[model samples]
Target: APFRMSFAASAKHVRVLENAGLVRRKVHGRSHVIRLNPAPLAAADKWLRYYERFWRERLDTLEALIRAEDKAATRKRSRK
Candidate 1:
């Protein structure tokens, strides 16, 4: 149901997708069949890699903080 499309709207949507490098269209009879192009995905993947590195650094900092807190708690318990 989600993939259901009318020819006119599909043509417009396909044009936008092609412009964005997200898809390619080939003429098949009266219809232009859409083929997915991977260029946009590659770009997205590159963008996400930067964010992944950022999150990894943040997580490492959090892990160190957690370990320090755990060691402090252990020391306090031992004294009590």
Candidate 2:
């Protein structure tokens, strides 16, 4: 493998994510099967969607302001 992570290190992070309700792990003999629990993910996506819209509108307003400033500058330059 090109990476240098030990199994212990991997398992530690898995435990954190599992505790956060992001993943589910099943132990079958020596094999540990990990899967995503999408409920938490869906909740996060729904929460973030509001901010996404908010920021998009904010950025759009910012862009409009910049464009208006550029137009004003252009008009001033043309008058010179």
Name the best candidate (by lDDT).
2
lDDT tens digits by residue: candidate 2, 15-49: 99999999999999988899999999999999899
lDDT of 1 by residue, 12-76 (tens): 98799899989988898987678899978999999999999999999999999999999999999
lDDT of 2 at 26: 94
Enumerate clash totals for all models, in the order shown: 0, 0
Question: After TM-score superposition, what is the CA distance of residue 13 in candidate 2 from its true location, in Å?
Answer: 1.4
Question: Relative to the true structure, how large is the alpha-carbon lDDT of every model?
Answer: 0.91, 0.95
Task: Give stretches of model 2 more than 4 Å off.
Answer: 1-3, 27-32
What lDDT is obtained when candidate 2 is compared to the true structure?
0.95
The TM-score that candidate 2 achieves is 0.75
Give the range where candidate 2 is weakest over 10 consecutive residues by summed lDDT.
1-10
Residue 61 CA displacement from its true place in model 2, Å: 0.8
